[model samples]
Target: MHTVDHLETLCARAWPALAEVPLGNWWMRAAEGFTGRANSTLTCGDPGMPIPDALKLVQRFARDHGIKPTAHVVNGSPAESGVEAAGWRVDLDHPGGAESLVMTGPLEKFADGVVESRDLPGWWELTAGSEITTAQRHVLGSGPNVCFASIVVDGVVVAAVRGAVVEDVLHVARLAVRPSHRRQGLARRLMGELAGWGLTQGATTCVLQVAEHNEAAIRLYEELGCTEHHRYRYWIPAVS
Candidate 1:
């Protein structure tokens, strides 16, 4: 469990938010309205200060950054109960915001070459949906350790994924497959390539975040030998 916590911390660093303010052992992150993981306060371990004081600081940090005061609490952690007791409500209304699982596995099982690294522009063209927002661009291209993986077929990119390696763990995100290319084992192949890339970069493990409601994706990852490491949910102050 402790090692899982440390791996998660490294994963957070890999896909960094736009702004991160340290509050004891917690990280108050802000990146507009991009994603909960990027905007919420990540309470990994003890804050080293009073919980109330830390909450106040988190509130102030969110307000200063013009984002809603939100906290990402590990499901079974002390912080979850504390924040809920303090009037913070789990953000169930947000799209797929209720519960997310952090899945982990070794990088040696999947076969390589199904995916290849590409530049930001090429990666975005293949992965981004019909429209791209400023916040999306920043979140996808923010970190230096990121690798943009894509699958090109018949001279056109169809499947893509992103991997960021930090502290021997590869954090995978932004996986997409074109509608015409779905159900062809593209996602699995892409993950295999990502695992291969991670191994070459000295990464021993791979992790990816998926909403609990995403049954298909969850099944796919499970079939690939990834198991849930932990769960987390976003908690926001109840509206007065």
Candidate 2:
């Protein structure tokens, strides 16, 4: 079993940010406000200083990048306590959720399909609302060993997912199925395709992050034998 910290480190590489700065053992990441995971300080390990002092640096980094002063902390961890004691509060307004869980399981190989080095227009059409932002492209395209998998039907993409292999882990994200294509197991197919692709790359396990409130997605992952590895929440300076 991989420790929480080890798993987090792998995921960090799987979905890289445009900028990653180390604050002692902590990681401060920024990607032009694209996603919280990429745009917040990750309070994982010791920072070689008091928590309050570390938080000051975190806020300063946020201000320098024009993003929220946020920290991604594992729930119930010492870092979480320190951040809270320093007047940081859980971010209930985060678009993803107040809390998120990491799920992992052994990779199950399925069938092979076309994989892309760069996201296609259909992927952007399915995942984003408007023109793809540079920050989004940076984060998505920045993964060290990443692949874009999708299922095309009638010359249109109805489902898509991203997979990145970091060490022996396959980190999956950007799962989406067109509303009209739901209930047809396209999501599973895409996952299986990614699994096949990952296995070829020597990945033995799969990991993904999901919001705690997303029961449906959790159920799908559970069916694929994934279990909760850890839960984390985004924190920000208290609204005082």
Identify the candidate with maximal lDDT: 2
- Candidate 2 clashing pairs? none
The CA lDDT of each predicted structure is 0.82, 0.87
Candidate 1 residue lDDT tens string, 61-178: 9889899888888888878888888888888886755889999888786647534568645568766665777767777776757788988888777888989888788889888898
The estimated TM-scores of all candidates read 0.92, 0.95
lDDT of 2 by residue, 189-232 (tens): 78877888888899899999999999999999988888999999
Task: Compute the lDDT of residue 67 as modeled in candidate 2.
Answer: 89
